[model samples]
Target: MNVLKRDMQLLKNSNDVVLARQKVRQWATELKFSLVDQTKLVTAASELARNALDHGKGGEMTMELLVNGSKSGLRLIFEDQGPGIADIQQALKDGFTTGNGMGLGLGGSKRLVNEFSIESEVGKGTKITVIRWK
Candidate 1:
């Protein structure tokens, strides 16, 4: 197994989000991820990408392909310089949205992956990492 890293600069626009999702889908497919797994990863990518654009005002995502022995995984890290989340616990709660969205992005994306983590500062920024193994 080997390790590979890729990075994308996100922008305050929808097109960048779409491109991010497409990159995730490509990596998932190249890894031979199951259809269900690929879909889950892509869906989560879309949600987080949107969050980076809308909430973060702009951010970046790092995608890594990890291989260990017979197993493989995908890791994504989203970072932004926008105003960070005020209440992480409240933000993680279902139906908790600061915007007009349905408020399911973070929680739902967490459920779709094997690992999820978030760090944020009120005035600094935010960082989120998620991983899915195959």
Candidate 2:
């Protein structure tokens, strides 16, 4: 895979989450993604960004324009250095949440993208990567 472009943003507060969504939308638009695709990516970005800020205690988001074979895609990586998730499987299950949410962030974000992955250490942190191909 070749990364055509890359950018990073700090997820420090709610404003940063909005900014992250805007940035994702801009990138998706630049890639000529459809309106529905743009909305899906932006929504996923918002959920992951909020998770980074609220559950991970503020983190960073990296956006990448990727080219693999003849396909182009947008990739998002969210990382945070806070108490990590203990049970990834349970977390990925719908209606499972440690916070006071409707419990659809992680699972819903996964459905919005073409690829999704997550890594976490109990006492270290968590990292989530998602990709949407166009």
Candidate 3:
């Protein structure tokens, strides 16, 4: 398996987001990810991509897809440059959303994947990782 990464500029417009997801889907298919795995991964990517635009106020985001050395599965890293998460714990609690939000996005996206983890700093940014097996 090979690893690939791309930088995304956060934009609220849906068309911009569609383009971003297309790039991710292309690379994911090139990696030969199984159909089921690809579906979940692509959905998760779309969610994160939208979050970057809607929540992060348009910032720089990095997307990385890797096939772990163990050869078991793929891991994806979606990182953004913004004011970072304010309340990490509250944010993870299902149905808790702050600002122009309908909630159920992140937590739901997390549940759709196998492994999910997040890191954030007050004034820095947020980095979220999700993985799915073959």
Which regions of candidate 3 fall more than 4 Å away from where they truly are? 1-13, 69-73
- lDDT winner between 2 and 3, please give it: 2
Candidate 2 residue runs with Cα over 4 Å from true position:
none
For model 1, how does the per-residue alpha-carbon lDDT over 1-134 read when each residue is reduced to its tens digit?
Answer: 57775656565688888888889999999999999999999999899888888888888888989877988899999999989999999999899999998889899999999999999999898999999999
Candidates 1 and 2 compared: the better one by lDDT is: 2
Worst 10 residues of 2 by lDDT: 13-22
lDDT for each candidate structure: 0.89, 0.97, 0.71
lDDT of 3 by residue, 7-80 (tens): 45444567767876776677668778777767877788788778766666554434556556766455656666
Q: Candidate 1, after superposition: displacement of residue 97 in Å? A: 0.5
Q: Which candidate model has the greater TM-score, 2 or 3?
A: 2
| Residue-level lDDT tens digits of model 2 in 34-81 | 999999999999999999999999999999999999999999999999
Please report the candidate that would top lDDT against the real structure: 2
Candidates in order, TM-scores: namely: 0.94, 0.98, 0.75
lDDT, candidate 3, at 77: 66
